[model samples]
Target: MKNLVNFKVAVKTRECLVQAIYQMLFNNDSVAKVIDQFKDEHKTKKVDFKMFSMSLRSINRNKKKIESILTSLEIKNSSMELIDKSILFFAINEMLFGNLDKPVAIDESLRLSKKFSSPESYKFINVSLDKFFKTLS
Candidate 1:
């Protein structure tokens, strides 16, 4: 179905978004550099490139606001893995700025954490982002 196809691309985009964020942290690359690298790497994939680029740009643009929220939650950067931190940043950015529903953002973040992070990281991500999500209401 068309919906299934769209869902795949959306999932791929979210995966890429989290990776891109991780790269920004892990590689110490500038947003512009990461964007360019991701574009080149995913040029032939079935990624929703527009959404990936927009979400990354938005996440980069709103870094300060996102950090402020995380600070309020007392989420210390060193305490979490880079992947978990990236997932939180992506989820919080989506919940705050992207068009997706908060639940979608949270669910996508959990999915990513389960796929790429430690077995127990999703629980931490869920609780932390849920706390952040509640503040938006």
Candidate 2:
């Protein structure tokens, strides 16, 4: 029997995306390895796999560029918690390169931070992403 949980595809996809990125940061796993890892997890089966894969692939392909862009925000990711950095990287990449709208990317980033990071980390994520957007306008 399969255990199924009810989660919106977008929400679950982003949740897994953050975790996959965090895992990659720590383990330095290739995108294929990480996607295979997620695919092997029954708990993650409900995610929007296309969204998750495309986002992860885009990030993988463009992570350095995205990192440079976010680095320009002066957040000093070198000192950031890995989870926080992962969340910022995940959301900002989605905002700039993926199909999600900017607001949705940001909102989902905050939500992911709240779920997986320090209690106050979401606030920092919010301010950082906001600053990134301000520079764009």
- Local accuracy by lDDT, each model: 0.88, 0.84
RMSD of each: 2.5, 4.5
Backbone steric clashes in candidate 2, count: 0
Native-to-model Cα distance after best TM-score fit, residue 38 in candidate 2, in Å: 0.3
- Prediction 1 global C-alpha lDDT: 0.88
Cα lDDT tens digits, model 1, 9-78, are 8888888889999998788788889889988999888787788889898988998888788889989987
Q: For candidate 1, which ten residues in a row score worst on lDDT?
A: 1-10
**TM-score, each model?**
0.92, 0.90
Number of colliding residue pairs in each model = 0, 0
On the 0 to 100 scale, the lDDT of residue 4 in model 2 is 21
Q: RMSD to the native, candidate 1?
A: 2.5
* Tens-place lDDT digits, model 2, residues 17-121: 999999999999999999988978945356877778888999899989888887788778668999999998898887788787888778878888888999999
